[model samples]
Structures are given as structure tokens and as C-alpha cells.
Target: MKQFRLHKVASVCLIAAMALIGCSSQGGEKAAPGTQPGASEGSGQQVTLSMHSWRVEDTEGYKAIIQAFEAENPNIKIDFKPFKATEYNTILNTALQSDSGPDILQLRPYAPGISLAEAGYLEPLDNIAGISAFPKDVLAAATGKDGKVYGVPLSLNSTQFFYNKKIFEQNGLKEPKSWDELIATAKTLKEKGIVPISFGAKEGWLLSLSHGVIAPASYSGSGYIDKLLKGESNLQSPEFLQSISRMQELIPYFPENYVGLELNDMRTLFATEKAAMFINGSFELEGLKKLNPDLQLDFFPMPTNDQKAVITTWVDGSYAVNAKSKHKPEALKFMEFMATKKFGELFANQFKRISAVPGVSTDDPLVNKMAELSQSSSTPYLMVVHFAEGKPTTKQALENALQGMYLGKLTPEQVAEEIQKSAATWFPPFKK
Candidate 1:
């Protein structure tokens, strides 16, 4: 039984005060060359450390962090590179296997962390400084089955149905509180010639958002995933099947070529007010803000058939050190810098990420409201947290199968059976 505790954010004034106070041991001191071995010293024999991440929006945020870090240690240079979200894993996998990976790697803790750590490509960070600042459940996500910490969590993410508040108000549309109401609202919106939802299904990975947003309300308190893993239940259960049907019902409200649209396209549709609603994780709020600061946005949990709305959240975005990096010392120094509370503040305030570090708060009003919703009723994203180990995991299979459903090539029952079939290969005796 993993506890889900939503740590409250500290005041912005307090965070700013702390940043000015320079509490971390690094403080504001520029050391001489070789003063701290791997750290940058004033003598300026620069140590360039490369980092790889999937967040393009984080470029400026990280640059600010790097600037602060370099202020104290003038001899180190950080080379940060961001890859496309869809192509990141493939490129990272190749780089790691060839011993040509970045010094610092940003990754998702579940499947990717597990695979890289198992292959000895990620360095365990059990001794990382300031690690105790993170909540136990948050830290646990980045720890492997072998009890070694391979990554430090950067954010705890929550996904909800983000709707254009102004659109809803202008159209006389009330936020739906039940699955049936949701469909009715969509129908009404479609009647008025507006896209009801702006979900992008073309990016294979984005398909999971279709169901992930619905998983919490459908299965959270039931210990459903645990039963499936222990072989006491399966995806074919009536309850699970019905959940798939709930997602399929949204197809008619989407764009005709919804399967051809990528996530960016969906964001454009919503931010441009072409779509009334879209399901997205909190990470997108910052980007959305930049896209249209005047865009009035609000969110509600994906309404369930049973009418118990629960926010689906996951511990997402972690930083891992490459096991074979020649600049381990420099990389470790940067990791220590990230562990600081000030870095957490910067992450929350500047990058618009829900910081994993304690006592950090965002100034964004919408983010704070979403955080409150998360605290009120939330559950971890199921497949990301509970899938049995194997290729084509339940997460992967669900994504693929849902894409079929979006294309009208698969029924809800077929989707359920497909998931069971995929899980059966990894967990024996899976129900048919």
C-alpha cells in the first residue's frame, strides 16, 4: 500500500528569501582550480559536461540553473541538449549501448529507468546529497527492484481534462461531472461546430493518455492492478472492459484526422481556442501559457462512469547519471546542485514543473488549483506503475490497441482482450 501524500507548496516569498540566503553548501563561493576536484574553480580549466533531456521548453530554465551553478564554480560548463519526445528513448538507447551517452540523462522512472539500470547503463544514486528532501514514495519511483536509486525524481505529474474556461462559459457549457454528462457535453459542442476534445493519437505514446486520464476514477481504490499482477484479476473483467468503452465513446468528438495530429497539434488546437477541451498533464501548462498567456484555462478530473472523479498522477521526469561517464565527479556535482531547494524553486516557478523537492511552490494560479484537485482525489497512473516486466508491456500494448480503437479498427472488447493477451505473455494464466 503506497501512500499518496500531496506535499503543500511553500510561499513564494519564503522561496525567494531562501534563494537570496544561499542555504546550500555550495553557497556563493568561487573556488580555485582543483579546490574541490571535480567542481569548477576560478582558475578556469573548464570541464564541459553534456546532459540529454526530452524537454525542449526546459532549455531556458536549465540554463538559469546552470548559470547559478557556474556562478559558484566558474570552471565548469554545461552542454544541455533536448531531443524530441518521440525519438528520445531510441536515441538514448543507442547512445548508452555505444558508450557515447551524455553525462546527465533525463528519463522516466518506470520502464525506461528499469531497463537502463538493469543494463548497467545508469549509475545508482543512493548517496546523492539532499536526497532526503524528496518524499519516500516519490524517491521510490526512481529506485530499481534491486533497491538501488538510479534517478532523482524531478516532478510529480497529474493529468486532467483541461478545458478552455472562456469557451465553456461562453457556450453555456458546464463542466461534466459524470461520464454520461461528458458525452452529452461533447455532443452539444459538436452540434455547435466546435471540436469537443483535442487529443492527438498519432504519436503512439500519446494514446495512453486516452486511458491514463480515466484509470484513477475507474480503478484507484479497488486494488485492481495489484490483483491483475497477482493473477487474481485480468483486463477482461467487466469493470475494466467498461472503462475501455468509456474512452472509445470520445472518438466521435475528435478531429476527423485526429490520428494524424501530434501532441503539438493538439496543443495548438486548444491554445488557439479551436477545441473546447483536451486531456493533458500539468507539464503542458507552462508551454500552453507561453503559447497564449491570455488563454483562460481550467481543468477537471476525467469524469468516470460511476461519477467518482479521481486525478491520475505519476512521478515523472527524473535525472540519472550515466554509469560510464568519464566526468562522474562533475556530473555528481551538478546532481548535488539540482538537489538544492533553490533549484526546486526554480523548477517550480520558472520551468512550471511540480517539483519533487520539498517546500517548493509555483506562482501559477492554474497550477495551484490543479495541485489542490490532485490532493483532493488522486491515484498513480496504473500501467506506468504496475506493468509486469517484458517487451510490449501493458502500457505499450494499451497505447497501440487504443490507437486501433481511434482508427475504428478495434472494438473496446478487442482492446481489452489485446491487453490481456499482451499481459498473458508476461504474466502466466492471465484471464482470457
Candidate 2:
């Protein structure tokens, strides 16, 4: 029942924002990093920079975030084009090929940078900010095979188990420290007329978020997805099947009608006190808090079998420079601001995620707990969140496979086999 939550987990979009004054500032656009702004040195004429995104609810928070940057530097204007994930991707894939489109938008690291870089459509950004201190995985996600960086990560996070504090204490149970303990505790709660785990199985990302997403890390035996992506290993193998089998063992522990539950169901089960535990990302803290601010919370990194603890992580976040925008310089300056602690403090406090910048803190005790759990990993392994739906051809097939697995229609071996088949045809080309 510990499944992924979408309202809490962010998907890829083409995210971009301009650092202009409150809709009035003007200046030459900022550059991404490795390349100069692809415009005349200084053009002040109506540079209405637009960026597309699938994050609608988060826009207000992000707007507040960008406003702080805008207050500090009032030169470039930003127009946010917001849409749901599905619509945004559909429009974006089409827009990237058209003349009229956003300067930046949200995208998964491998898909956006790698594919676009291969197409020779993305502008390199290594020269401008010189983000030398940036974490290697963050830098790696942005860089194409040619070693050109196309974007920067705005936040760093790892998916973990988020469970009810009251439930554990009431059941005379401690938060589980091992897979066996988890099963024992969940059984105790379920027998008491309380579901032990809550999750949104209806969403494909949730399945991927909780289980399918970590195939590369588990299969490679390297214990990290970022490492596998760096030519460290192959994905279509039995080691990955081992991880999928582990998840399958827990299906009996999920709600009896688990397949009937949709994307928000499991989260709702926990939020309403019907379930004792849930597994999701730190981003869910905001919504979970809004429902019950006193919701006592704690997190444990996803379990491991003989291997070290691993967390499925998304190494990329929304925000990219347009390859054709006139206000590139101004946009990048704002991005620099985003890369600062001030920006992290302003935006990351509520989502409960750890900031990528050097310094930022939250008074919330739970966020600190998740951060503490992640300290064991070298750099957060971004590979656990291997994006299967890299393009239109693969997205639907992967989604169907996820749905089939949830319904018991597909066994772990079958799930692994189907995904393995897609991996050959679906792995998009690296950037040019």
C-alpha cells in the first residue's frame, strides 16, 4: 500500500521563468551556462519570454519564488505557460519543433537534455554560471553525451517511507527498520481494522515511484542509477528482476482491493487516518500538512536486501533556458539566484524537500529526518527514478505495464520482461 503520490511528487515539464521586473523590466536575456544568449548583445524591445510547465498548483509557490528573484533583478520578463503533465508534454513535444514556444519548460533530465542535445536543439550552459561546486549527478543530468549542459536541477530529493506517528505508537509498534518489521507492523494494523499502508496504485508514476523506477540501480548492482547511466552497467538483466520481486512480495500487504484504489486513494487513506503508513517523497509534506498540520511524520529510506539502502531520486527539476529566447542573459541571472540559499529558503520550506543550494533549513522535524536518512548515500542516486516514458512511443506501453502489474495481470518477471523489451527500443539517443 505504500505507493507514490503525484500531488506530492513532481513530474517533468519544460519549466522556465524570467527575472524581469513585475512584468515591466527589460534587458538582454541571460545565458544558460556553456553558451552566450543567442540574441543581439542588448535588445530591450518587448522580450516576452515564455516558459511551459505541467505544474499548476505549484506555480503560485514558484511565482512567489521567482518574484523574490524579480525583486532583486528587474530586467527580464517571464510569462509562465502552465498545464497538466499530459497536456504540457503533448504541447511541448510539438512546440519544440515549432517556432513559437517557451524559452524553457519542465523536462526529465534524460529525456529533455539527452534527446534535445542529440537533436542539436538545446543551448549549452557550462560557460556562464561555472557551477563548479554543483553536485556531480546534478551536473551530469544536464550534460549531453557531447558534454554540453542543457539545464540545472532546482531541488534535490529522495523517495522514502512516510508513516503515521499516532498509528505506530497506538499499535505498540516502532517505525519499521527492516522489511520483516514492516510486514509485521503492517499486519498488526490491518488486523485491527486499519489498513497498514496507503498508496495511489492507479497512477503509473506511483508504481514507478515506489517500485518500477529503481530498476537500473537494483539491476546494475552498483547501488545507484546515476552510476548506471554513466555507462557503468546494463539495465536489462535479472538483478533488476530481483528488485521487482521484492516489491511483489509486498502486494499481499497492500489493501485487498488495492487495484481498485486510484492515484489519490492511498494518500487519502493515510490522511484520513484509515491507514497507518504511506511511502512517498518529501514534496508530499505540504499537502499532508495542510490536511493535518499536527500529522506526526518520519521517514526511512527504502529498504534493501543484502545491498545498501537506496532511494529513487529525480535528478532534474523544471527550469531551462530557451535556445531561441531574446532574454537569455536575464533568464540565467535569475537561475543563478535560484541556485542560491535565499531561493531555497523561499521555495523549498513547504514542500519539505531538501534544497540543492549550500544552505537552507526547515523548522519541521520530519524534513530533517529524511535528510538524515539520505546522508548515507554518496550523492543521492538519481537513477532509481529511471524515466521509461522518454518519448511518445514508450510512454503508453510503460503505463500499461504498470497498470497490468498492479492488477496481478503481470507478474514481476513479466513486468521486467516487458520493460526489458521496451528498453531496447525506448532508450532515446544521447545529445549531439
Q: What C-alpha lDDT values do all the predictions have? A: 0.74, 0.57
Give each model a TM-score.
0.88, 0.78
lDDT (0-100) at residue 319 of candidate 2?
A: 62
- Top candidate on TM-score is 1
Model 2: lDDT to the true structure: 0.57
Backbone-clash count (model 2): 30
In model 1, which regions exceed 4 Å deviation?
1-44, 220-222, 428-432
Q: 347-418, model 1: which lDDT tens digit per residue? A: 888867678777777787776776666667766676766552458677889988988988889999999999
Point out the worst 10-residue segment of candidate 1 by lDDT. 13-22
